[model samples]
Target chain A: MKVSFFPGCSLEGTAREYGESIEAVCKSLDIELQELSDWSCCGASSAHSTNEFLSVALPARNLSIAERKGQDLVTPCAACFSRFKAAEKALTCESKVDVGIPFQGKINILHMLEFLCREEFSEDIEKKIKRPLKNLKAVSYYGCLLVRPPRVTDTEHWEDPQALDILISRLGGESVFWPYKTECCGGSLVLTRVDIIHRLNGRLLDMAREAEADCIVTACPLCQANLDTRQEEIGDKEGVSYDIPIFYFTELMGLAFGNKGVRKWLGRHLVDPRPLLESKGLI
Target chain B: MELIGDKNFRDVVVDAVGEEIFTCYQCYKCSAGCPVSFAMDMLPHQVIRSVLFNQKERVLSSRTIWVCAACETCTTRCPNEIEIAKVMDVLRQIQQESGKQAKEPKVPIFHKAFLDSIKKTGRVHELTMIRNYTQKSGELREKLKTGEWKNDVRLGMKMFLRGKLKVMPPKCGGVKEVKKIFEQAKEHKKA
Candidate 1:
């Protein structure tokens, strides 16, 4: 199926691996991604805080563009998905009049996790896995926004959003339950303000480590950026120890596809997923 | 700088503030990062404590309630997962409805204006939001002096040309569900 795909800013920049992995996996799934023509920024964390209108309009413009094309907008970035969904929610709320913002047309925003969890795709995914991820213990981290406000994301469930865990389990990897799975990864504060990040990141890593998982899998780009890139720094300052690699859900799926050169996509990972992928006997 | 009541309203305060009040260890981490805390008569932690202490009048009327940007810094810091920002939202709703007088903070007004802009336009139209906010806040002259008009006009024109800013609002689906959510929020305030 072809749908308008929004890779978000991070996916274009630091998280290109995520984009590549998504493309790789989609191709394997026989799904076609039609890029939205001339899409703009999703207003991210900055726009939402600096100017509400800019935030909503930035994403709405992209959505409206996608809506005009008669396709749902699918995004890989959790923040992008959440922000886009938020704008759609704000526009749809009748109280937009009360707040002085009026209702606009809505766009269907889908996160990659939701897309991969489709029943039809599941059977194909189960059948296509050439290398089962047997004995690979993994932790699934949601890191907020994916299933939040429940209404916005429209995922399976709000409090217990486990599609990621379910997907990991389907790949023959055992998904471990960790407490900090849905907790905040400190969002944009990773740069501008970071006094709290060391603690937050440390705690999350500690939880996954405690769960004795081989690696942590996440769907959000920012979360991956923070967890993967900053793990060493957090380990340094907090005096904690962790060398576990962070895997994008797509990266894992790409591995399950068991195609050649798939390891290169995982190779681009900051945390060196080779050791973990090797443990699953894919390497 | 002021303690409004003598009684230890800790139970009432904790109940009102919810469970996250005592979770704070007074790290000042939230205040350090807060954008509007400089203008707050009470720090973010103190406001949480005031609510925890059942000092409703003082907590609701404090300048801190008005100054919060809803940045969620305190909530982010609280080791106990207390939603200090959400609590401030509840307090702001109370302050607005009680007709109690408190100094209006710039950030909250800006946020309201921002939300108002979205509410009206279905998406945010920057020029309209700033204009509406300036007029409502009576900051038009200062806004003009700050050269906000020139920059806004330039950017607004650019966005308009790009078709990012819609000239009209979009029709809403599930209007009743949205309304019900708002109605429940209102009832929450009344209760």
Candidate 2:
């Protein structure tokens, strides 16, 4: 399947492994990722927090670019997906805004997990799993964007999304049920309010342990950064050794696909997921 | 911003958002579902109530709107079908227009530095964005005062060692288009 890919800013910087792993897995599956040439930022939380018009217009610009491609647009970053959804809502709904761009909102936008979940890919996906992510108990965290605002995102099960869990099960891994699966991680507030991030992310880490999960898996770059990079600080502040690896869905897919670049991607993790994968004997 | 209505603050908000604000019957589901409500000075339900009562200044000055992560969990679970997150966004827009306040001051700085990075490079480079954020927020000095900057510096160095912090941004080909979008969107705000 060929699709327009928008590797938002995080993928190039902090989430480089996610970008690399997505490419590696897609190549193994014979799926072509035609990157949206010069796709700019989605305006994320910043634009909406300051200016609404700019927020919708920013993503509308990219949507316009992809609309011309006449292909379904896909982004791995949930933040970008949500931002594009916002633009789609504003440009196509009853309360449509004139974003000064020719955004028909005709292209169907999907997150990477959603793109992989298509029925046509499942048989091929099962055929591609060489490592069979056994002994990998994961909490498939959907975070905030992938499923929320039921009307805007049009997500059927917003409160209890099953997209990641479905993908994890198909990959030969066990997924744990947890209440904080869709909780907020104080995104972008990491630099502004570390205390808030500690409190919020600490709750998620503690809950993951309570659920007896091995690692927290997510598709959003901000959620992973907040959980992975800040795990140690939260552990120290709370006086407990909460050692957990936060994995991107793509990384685990690459691991299961037995793609060679999985290790290089895993090595970039702040929490270093190597020990977890090694302990599972899946590496 | 020249809201659609000028008679009352409630009308202004309803116009910016929708008529859903009137449908909110103080269910408190929004506040209950909010993950960060523990840190909010004004709860999500209370923010809506304040707006309904036309408490514009109080709603704008409170820390609840800024602390909100826009998770939309509240919006998803609202029994009244009110999109609370959109209301929060409108409140934030009005707050930005009314001039700066001291509640969660650093949050706006983060947004500014964030958008400025996108404006300059057509995408956000973490190192550059964070540098600009720290410079604007005086976060380093504040952390130095409390001796907590060590942790931040250590974390950044670790990210750098992992090669996650790139020294240069990618060559974005649509920077001019992005700038034009921003300019035209500003015009949209004006009209």
Candidate 3:
């Protein structure tokens, strides 16, 4: 249960709730999160989009540090998980990538969702749930990073991933089946093209609404922010109102575990999740 | 690396991406599955075709490469297993290096602003990054010129009130190492 934690950049600010809920839920599950000291950013979309070498090298620096620890490294951000895994894949597959650091590819880079789905943790999660989420229909949104390019993430059923849905089921919430679960939310275009993002996320929210999902559950910080914040504008422009709140998969786990810290963590969202949580009588 | 009839472009692509573009076979599956195709000037399949035909100018000038969100959905579903997202990245890097104005405009600005933030701080400071982006993006200036500029100050205020926007970035002990990685990576660029 002891794993090195890499709380990526967004977890510091925009996704603070995710970090808080992750820490709170892991404690409730008795999982020890050893902080990876002084980890750099995983280079997300920018590094790869600009310089291919930096994409591998920036993550290589972090992996070099984590590799020395010899423990499973888990990050809350799906983008970071993908970036770290990309570096590991390159280092393992190629011999010429010397980013001035020796990386042996000894550690397993795991997304927090992937970590939670571990058999030992999933088996024990049900026992710790003091209050099961009833009447909460959540559509698990994996976004793009966690499940695509299956060779890198090694995720089976990448097109229709069940990691978050299974966790939702264990938390006693109804995991609604939805096709837009793996759709891209245009996360990398957040600063560049808000117009494109609005349209793309509009499609996602529209599908979620049609799926009758009371709220969308996700693990990516950017997806949660984009889906939550821009939804109002998308509604105003499209004349189809959307009020669905976004939740980190861990936040729900913390709530189901009856962790008291989750009460504050729920308040950080742009589209307030508390209304739905309260109406469901789960808050 | 033959210099005849798209062979140079083909070799460059094969060097950066892989030879998968040669195997694409015009399936159009990648373009069909791409989520951001609505904003792209060229479809994914067409870009592959452009590359195969040595239409480097057309491929680089198009907004498709810059606008691609790198979602990798197209790459995943490619029957030929072409790494379409990586190809987009490769094309963008080439475009950036070409020193021409990006037709997609603000995306490259955002990318530069993001990387500079990372190079300076070992991580992105969102508010700072966005501030840098707005300052550098000429499209924003054009919006301002035409009085079409709609600022997100309200959104900023909302995020700030929600405690999502931090006024100051955290201290990162590994920032020096990050700069070193950037320095070493320059040698890695395929010249």
lDDT of 3 by residue, A38-126 (tens): 88888888899888889988898888888888898999998999999888888888645556678888788899988888898766798
Runs off by more than 4 Å, candidate 3:
A94-96, B1-7, B139-151
Those runs of model 2 whose alpha carbons end farther than 4 Å from true positions after fitting are B1-7
lDDT by residue (B1-191, candidate 1, tens digit) is 22223334345334444666667777777677565565678988787766665677777768776545444445554557776765775666555555555565444455566555444433334456556666766566665888756744664464344333445433333233333333333433322
The prediction achieving the highest DockQ against the true structure is 2
Question: Clashing residue pairs in candidate 3, if any?
Answer: none
Task: Tell me which of candidates 2 and 3 scores higher on DockQ.
Answer: 2
lDDT score, candidate 2, position A100: 71
Please report how far candidate 2 places residue A124 from its true position, in Å. Answer: 0.7
**Ranked by DockQ, top first:** 2, 3, 1
The DockQ score of candidate 3 comes to 0.79
Work out how many backbone clashes candidate 2 has: 0
Which window of ten consecutive residues has the lowest lDDT sum in model 1 chain B? B173-182
TM-score of each: 0.64, 0.97, 0.96
- Highest TM-score: which candidate? 2
| CAPRI verdict (incorrect, acceptable, medium, high) for model 3 | medium
RMSD of each: 11.6, 1.9, 2.1
